[model samples]
Target: MSELTTLARPYAVAVYKRAKETGTADKWSDALAFVTLLMQDEQLAKAAANPKANREQFSEAFLGLCKDHLDTEAQNFVRLLIRNRRLDLVKYIAELFNQYKAEDEGYIEVDVSTAFPLKDAEQARLSSVLERVLEKKARLRVDVDPTLIGGVYIKAGDRVIDASIRGQVERLAKRLWT
Candidate 1:
């Protein structure tokens, strides 16, 4: 994990706890996403990263942009982050928060690296197959990696399935050498 992610984890956990208690995990997820998007603004990002910038001013401007999209709890959450100088970690926090939400909702995020791009039908089939094998609803994020040589490599949480041609060759080479 990145240093920022480690720092953001506690905040994400706090938000997640509130979300669970209020049964509004989805709302919190959306709010975090929206706040993260807003943070991408060039001016806002500069101000957020500037230690000399006025926290009150920055918080008001940030909250103003968020008031329409975020609930009161989310606004308060933003203020707390600003007060603690953690605005820059919003993206990581949002990511971790969403992952927590997905797990709670019985979904597993999967990363599939393949030598070639998959067609819509191919992606659907692969997703279905992964869901069956993993026994959880899979959310696949696909990437084309020519180094894979052929086939696919699947990463879901701590589990890795190396079905790629390059991976097979490396395994065979390792066994032969041993």
Candidate 2:
């Protein structure tokens, strides 16, 4: 994991820098996201990682798949990754690029899990509160997990706020033991 991260960081940085200069971070994000999707496909991933596959042929096929979604610069980026045999790192690059984009845009990526799906009003209220607490705009990825029992669980970077019914019960049980 560390090795992959180390290899991916430089590519992410370069992409982020290019996006910043071109004033096209959103476009770059979309392009990288498309690449990420392709890489996630089992067949395509296998083809990309197959050591016996001809490099030039695969690169052409890959770029062909990306033709509509990627701009010229992004196509070049894909070519560079193919040349470096780092196509497998597309997901990590996209993730790191998003981190860079979010930090620069004064936003925090937050995960909010609830026992039930959040209403639009609830989501707005929660987002507003989190923005205040985190001191950055909150970009929430909300999910519903039945195991949470009730209420919400929020995570941002290393911080976690557990307000779920199961968490409350666990805390209470621990206190009673003490």
Candidate 3:
């Protein structure tokens, strides 16, 4: 795992526990989504990175941007992050939080890359196969990559099964060279 992932795990777990206790998982999900978006904005990210911007300024700007979307609990969470200087972990935190949410909901996040979009039936088949392979229900995100040539690359959590033509060719070339 990356350092960011390591740093993010505890925060994600804490938020998940709070959401579970309060029966507000969806609300926290929305708030975290907003925080993730705010962190992605270039200007806001730069401002957050600026040492001259005090914690109060960062918290105010962040909460201001998210005012309509946030509840008191969410606002306090943002303030806590700012005070702890963990704003840079926002993205990673969201990622980990979503992972926990999915697990709690009995869903696995899968990434699939193929040369073209799969039909509805094809997608269903892929999801079925992945569910069977992973022993969990899957929610897949499909991406079309022409450079893949053919076949699909499936990633479920830390496991990657690359069945793409490019991957196969590269392996073949490596084997031949060796």
Most TM-score-accurate candidate: 3
**Candidate 1, overall lDDT?**
0.92
Give per-candidate clash totals: 0, 0, 0
Report residue 14 deviation for candidate 1 (angstroms).
1.0
- Per-residue lDDT of candidate 2, residues 47-157 (tens digit): 988988888999999999989999999999998998888999999899899999999999989999999999999999999999999999999999999998999999986
Note the Cα lDDT for every prediction shown.
0.92, 0.94, 0.90
Cα shift from native, residue 20, model 2 (Å) = 0.8
The model with the greatest lDDT is 2
lDDT of 1 by residue, 107-132 (tens): 99999999999999999999999999
lDDT at 160, model 2 = 99
Model 3 lDDT vs. the true structure? 0.90
Q: RMSD (Cα, Å) of candidate 1? A: 3.6
lDDT of each residue in 29-119, candidate 3, tens digit only: 8889888988888998888778788889778978988899999988998898888888888888888888999999999999999998899
